[model samples]
Target: MHPELYLSYSSAFAIGLLGSTHCLGMCGGISASLSMALPVGRGFRFRQTLLLLAFNFGRIGSYSLIAAGVALLSTQAAGQWAWAGLLLMTLAGVLLIFMGLSMGQWWQGIRYIERAGAPVWRTLSPLTKRFLPVNNAGQALALGSLWGWLPCGLVYSTLGWAALQPTVPSAALTMFFFGLGTLPSMLATGYAAQWIRSIKSHQGVRKISGILLILFGLWTLPIQALLNL
Candidate 1:
């Protein structure tokens, strides 16, 4: 199976970025809340920062596991890797369309599954309560990890794309990068994401990002056609 160049292609560096416009709300909201919820103290800010890093670390770890598992399954799938490319293309196209609609305010359920991860989030979230009136950095970090379990469609879609990679390690790395890519925006929200969120409207962000996703989908189509994927 030829998993070269496009086979294990990186999506905009981090596949997660493509979904940022939509994720701004759910992830953004949670981050803002987490930042505010930190126990008040001179070290609150410092503790909050560590909390964010830890949360994302756990989150990316989970995503990597999922991506690697999928990649292993795909790595061995009947190949020329046609199915892999086809699936990526399909997902890209669907995401582009849905993101486009979502950007225009046509729908809001795109984030529903992100809530499904809430069961885990709920279990982990209460653990954060133990740290309230926030005493130490470790507790804040644990809080972030608990919140990181948040269900996100963007994360799920990116995992699917990574799974399409023929090599499991590449898939894991791809997800790791994707997670890193998202860290900036998410972290910003954690500390001060509200400022950015205030300036830009989700619809505006979605419309613009939606177009980018469509172009990405188009780019994948040619690869699919070449492979007859």
Candidate 2:
């Protein structure tokens, strides 16, 4: 893999991991509830872990699907204009900056993007209730897949970066990596909710994360390459 491309992929992963702090606030309660809903048994811990894993698998799989679709559209656009990647990436960078600002508590701009996705989430959210008291892996999987559609600014921001990739495989891989990055935090939320919440509340942590995210957004700008030259 080219060093530059590898860096982008790493950035996607880092973005997900960094943003998982936000996920703690967004999905932490849901994750805990999901755990409690599991059937009690001798192997409860084992089964709970498996269900959590399945849930995330379904969620991340959905993300990969969206990334692939976006990449396909971007490919078509790229065919029409050689500079499509640059343009798309620039747009994504702006979104990341907004996300950073939101994380830093400097602005509430990302909520607008969340609101835009609310209609779609409203439609999908109802279906998730049907899977309540998840009894099996399949039910857990289905519920997580639906949960992926929940209105989330962090997801949308990382998704824009995923769409900016030049190829479908690369874009899909980007989302997959992002999901991997988020796995730890989500898993921790299931078992260590208080610990995760403490991390989420630390003002210094958010400030540092916001700064890093902003720098990452700047690094993706096409002008950065020009500046390097």
Best by TM-score: 2
**lDDT by candidate, in order shown:** 0.63, 0.83
**TM-scores, one per candidate:** 0.73, 0.92
lDDT of 2 by residue, 1-229 (tens): 8776687688888999887887777777778777887777799999889888888888888888888988899889988997786778787887888888888888879899889889988899989989887888898899888887777888888888988877899989888888888889999888877888899899988888888888878876788654554
Model 1, stretches more than 4 Å misplaced?
1-15, 39-41, 79-85, 104-149, 200-202, 222-229
Clashes of 2: 0
User: Best candidate per lDDT, number?
Assistant: 2
Q: Report the error of model 2 at residue 1, Å.
A: 3.8
Off by over 4 Å in 2: 39-41, 224-229
What tens-digit string does per-residue lDDT give for candidate 1 at 1-229? Answer: 3446344445635445656555566566755666787778798887788767766676677667777877777767636555556666566556544544554466655566456666776676667677664444565555545555567666665665575565787788777877777777778878777576863475566566666655655554545365652
Model 2 weakest lDDT span, ten residues long:
220-229
